[model samples]
Target: MISEFTRTAVPQLVGHELEFSKSQHEEKFHSLHEAESVIREELEELEEQAEVCRKLFEDLHSDTRQDDKDGAVINAKYLAGSAEYAAYEAIQLAAMCLKLVEMAGREDEV
Candidate 1:
């Protein structure tokens, strides 16, 4: 009965479309948030690690961060690292959304 019902088909179609849109938007949002968070965390880590580098520089009386201006010029490095992690998280999110889409499609077929 369910397989032969047009009403059922209509709802599943609408649901799939809505889910596709919502999931895409949410996937982007999730990716953005994850990237932001990763950047923040990695920057903090780099700063902390730089401190260690600084300390090593200090113990040796070296000026490691001076020419770089407190790592001001290394934004690209941070983004590079952040982007690496971001892809993993974003891909996972996308896969999850696709799985949802696939499940919806399966239900629609039924």
Candidate 2:
């Protein structure tokens, strides 16, 4: 009786295993795709932010009055502002990447 049961159940078990594996594979693939999308979006955002910062810095630098006695002060202010913007942007990007990485790790575990 036991042998008869095994013979019937074994075939069904094999089919179930195959289906489960396929489902698992698809899930993993989808997860990886999502992670890639996140990376791509982050990269695009960073690039745009950098471009804006660069343009702003250039504009500020160019607007400095060359003949004015306060020209040095204007240039210094522009430099400081640019530096602060760049640092803030760097920190934001780092945080975004860190969160993405952590999320990916959690998904992988699941």
In candidate 1, what are the lDDT values of residues 1-110, reduced to their tens digit? 54668656545554564466555654332443554564465456545555544444453332234555445435444545555554444444444445455545666798
Per residue, candidate 2 scores C-alpha lDDT tens digits across 8-103 of: 865555445435544554323245566566557656765776676676556556555344436656655766776666544454444444445555
How does candidate 2 fare on TM-score? 0.43
TM-score of each: 0.35, 0.43
Which structure among the candidates has the greatest TM-score?
2
Top-scoring candidate (lDDT): 2
